[model samples]
Target: MCLLNLIVRLSYVDHTQDVSHTGRVVELKNYVRGLLLDSSGPLTKVELINHLQRLGVGYLFEEEIRTVLDAIWKGKDIEIENDLHATALRFRILRQNGYDASIDYFNSFIDEMGSFKACLCEDTKGLLSLYEASYLAFPGETRMDEAKAFAKRHLKDRKGKIDTRFEEQVDHAFELPIHYRMLRLEARWYIDMCEKDETMDPVILELAKLDYNILQASYQKDVQNGSFPTMYYRWWRQLGLVEKLPFIRDRWLECYLFSLSITYEPQYGYGREVLNKVNQMITLLDDTYDVYGTVEELELFTDAIDRWDTSAIKQLPEYMRTSFLALLNFGNDLGYDTLKDQGWDVIPCVGKLDEIARGDVPKSIQCYMHEANVSEAIAREHIRGIIDETWKEMNKEYVTDHVFPRAFADAAVGLAQRAECVYVNGDGFGRNQSNSEINGQVMSLVVEPIPINNV
Candidate 1:
């Protein structure tokens, strides 16, 4: 007879008698067996307890269930799945008669133990030892070792004697997660600033906003595809906005490394190599701007820096300070190099062509005329001087009369056209189009006009 049938039979001694505590024990065994059989595979201890509670089983003690499970699994009447850290057991009734008989006998032995821990205590360690064991069981999951190293610098507690396991767990959890979280928050702040800053150009701000949204969407897709954990993906998606904000890209990379340094031990050679590459990129960007960018470009750069303005330097976080200082030094070095390269001379002014043509009836605007086509250096120099002088006298009045009014009229016409397009596309007037289809159509209309004389 099978062990389950034997137990069921044993539960009722006389055929007419009332069912006793043995029947209750038999019922408990049957309950566990039924749950395991119904499951696709093995169940965790916690899952098994939850299953029993849900089934309305009375007098169900975790310890008692654990004891029965262990015995049934050991006798090969139940198969135990090998997990990463422990065995997750499942019952299979129709395996072997001898196995069933052995399990039935072992079940009685377990019952004599008075409680589940009487058997469990023989194999497992005490609370503190179990805490250490938990860390050892999954080294990747618990960064307690890293936390210990970090705490050592601040704590008076001696090595190997500090009772800060629980504290370390909590701290490590947030420490590893918070850096990326802050990066995301800061990225969002920069994106919002682009939209709201009065000094910022609308076109540039709109581009930054688009870049922010694209990176965020890509990060989220990667997370959903399981390339990273949801927590890491969510944090990284926020940080992805950093790339869209001017001057924050390098700072974001530094923050990324700072966070990594806590969870991962830096191998000296590899770590140094990566840091050197990052420094080189920063140097390259500095050189590119110094050699190529105009004063107007520098003004934009300065504005970006000023957006994060703070009175006290110490108020910035340590990692942020490190990143900002690196960028600041790069900008300062570039400024000095640019000044030296230009022989400390001021940038030459380009004057108004219309004003120059007003005083001297030149065939065409001298400023618009290319220097390359000028036959002699003397002629080029004379033309440039006349343009500058004429600009100093009448450039402001000419701009007020011609340029400002024309620009306002053109802008008004463009806005009206855009409004019509929006209305035709079933969108409200003045509502900014986000999709590429509408933006592309609007951009098509912004093409430079060909000369009417050529047409």
Candidate 2:
């Protein structure tokens, strides 16, 4: 109904070329489902499930995959294949999919010294499987810890010594285990890898490629349509943050990708857009506190944010007025939207958070650095350990029911994962908005659509 909505969002992605793509996707999906239904062996079923998941079309076949996995999730080895690679792959996939596949299943391979037999070192696929699954272990799984160490030490040594094709995946898994990588992004990368894999099922691969592009188009449209970031960009331009403040900058893509990492399902557009706004706001406040604001000025800004009132803006510095007012407007808009849709006025729930008290001012990394009197590197290691611990805790929570919406819980974890991704090598927000890691990730997720070629 507005001028902004009038501007179409073609993004050079043509639907006419893809008119048959929709039909092909449905056709291939049914074929894959039939394979799941007819597959006679556990090995074939589990392997197909992994391919579906890694190729990103697994979501399309969730019901079939779930039904198959439920049938295959017998905790005993009598039903599963006896080999290390098959068993380890099943363990990792099952655990990841929320089944309590025990780490004890791997005890048969451990020797008297509690070390994984050197025989496993010769089994490259088995070692890779073990290495990946070890990361999924909960706290106090010492055997898994040993498994990781053993697998990692050998995998690194055997890196280039194996088949060139598998080595590509070895390098990928070594950089970051698939468990930690966001799904949609990982799928983009894996789709290419799966395409190159000679044994990959053609129908399934075609479905993955097509479904990815289809959902990707939907995501891009979300970026341009109702509750649009393009609309937000226009508002941001109107805000004149870069011009007036001369420090505030736009990070719409990064924020959107961060939100997508939270949960990329097309149905979660409202939640994704809202989460994008939250990320953008965090960027602005982070810049104000860390890059621009003086100690005294930050104190004033913090107080204004705490008060959540226009009256406080009267006492603030000239440059601070617009940022503070914009923050208030954001809160008000969210409150208004919540009421209009849900019939519940949540303005009362609006409250200022992150009022760090005294010694609590030091966050995890800083706290570890000061408390242990360790180098920054060591403190960073300590923080990574905390992240790993938190993940295990979340893994425990993930298997149980929670009161929070699934999206909320997912976004909470995704927020932490985004921080890790953005800041992994260095500032993902900084460095000209391009790095080999995030630049490639963003391109895969948003910028470049997968080529819609024939299978």
Candidate 3:
């Protein structure tokens, strides 16, 4: 027969028993083994084919051999796991005898079938298969949008009356909460889209503004209804802003929850930045408490502050001198406090301030202290006061503009890194087209120029 026929016929016979089979099979196997032995770790399907051609296997079609090899390699119960493992085994053989027997026989079949898309689309269930493949191929926001757009178009074109329940379910999938407590989510998404996407359509800003108004209205209604206290506390807890307001014991858990969200969500830029500042504040507060306040006194103060009890501030132990000082500094920096006497929820603690000043207060606390404006002196004092000598040594100039800005920039960089890594794992279309498009949209939304006039 022909060379291909001879090779195929030889494959069925045991090499040990048949001299002719032994010679041909040994020669082909050695050739493949040698190719893999000399190279690096994993070769792609194309690389494997070219290597086979270079081996001078006249009868063996590289594509056909690749198909069989790939099947044997990827299958769990096979003698070898996959091409990488096969390549390793071949490498070992080459080191011993200057030949490799490892050849991927399944790649030829794949080449014959052409691209993954063509094979997927050739089936009778073309549309469903295509969608399923797309879902498997692209996930997260990219796939979600595609699926939503497809469903919306499909439903709109249908002549029959759509099932209202099914339609409601579809709408609910994309629905976001509109209450003031949750409006931050929408704001975050809008801000991220604006910053990250180069071609972010301006129309999205209109939607965001409308949503902001709705949330504001809801908040006002809740305030009038005397539900503001509960909702406000809950919001603080959920957004992790409560760590800065330690007196609010009822919402401590909520604060932790919000902190976790801030860590993960790139869209929560404002909240995230604020949370980092709050973390620094917390460290400073803790340091003050350790130096100037007893644990019992601090605990009691926390309870009193949450209750908005002005009198309890007077009852603070002699050791709890720095507690009120820290609180005052924090209030000044943030521009508002629940304890301000003029507000509806105010509880005047003026006398308590006198007691704190009597303690061993830092001079910077007196000079850099103001509620209206934060001077460079104040910023420097705060940074130096909190970061000890060791931490300063570990990361010199850690609080300078270069280092501090890293926290802010990390969200954008992290998103970009994740997108790039995920794209690398996928097909060319996903890598080149879909992921690039998504990244473009994200970058446009995040870094879009803000109109100075609007500000």
Worst 10 residues of 1 by lDDT: 91-100
Q: Which ten residues in a row have the lowest lDDT in candidate 3?
A: 174-183
User: On a 0 to 100 scale, what is the lDDT of residue 26 in model 3?
Assistant: 52
Residue 21, model 3: lDDT of 33
Instruction: Please report how far candidate 1 places residue 206 from its true position, in Å.
Output: 58
- Predictions in order: lDDT: 0.32, 0.75, 0.35
Residue-wise lDDT of candidate 3 within 1-455, one digit each (tens)? 12223224323432232244335455545555454444333333323432332222212353454453454344333322333233333322221111222223223212353322233222222222122222111112243234324434443443144455433423332241111012133344444444343553333333333333332233333323434323433443444433554432222222222342334333443353344334334433444453545567767766555544345667676444344544544445444443353354322443233334323245443445554268766765574444323322222222224544544533333332332323332321213222443333322222222231231
Model 1 agreement with the true structure over 9-53: per-residue lDDT tens digits: 333333221134234345545545554445343344424432333
Poorly placed runs, candidate 1 (over 4 Å): 1-125, 135-247, 250-270, 275-455
Best by TM-score: 2
**What is the C-alpha lDDT profile of model 2 across 274-391, one tens digit per residue?**
7776666666776677678788998888788777778999878999888888778877898999989998876544434223221233466877888899998999888888878877
Clash count for candidate 3 is 46
User: What lDDT is obtained when candidate 2 is compared to the true structure?
Assistant: 0.75
Which pairs of residues collide in model 2?
none
Report model 2's TM-score to 2 decimal places: 0.89
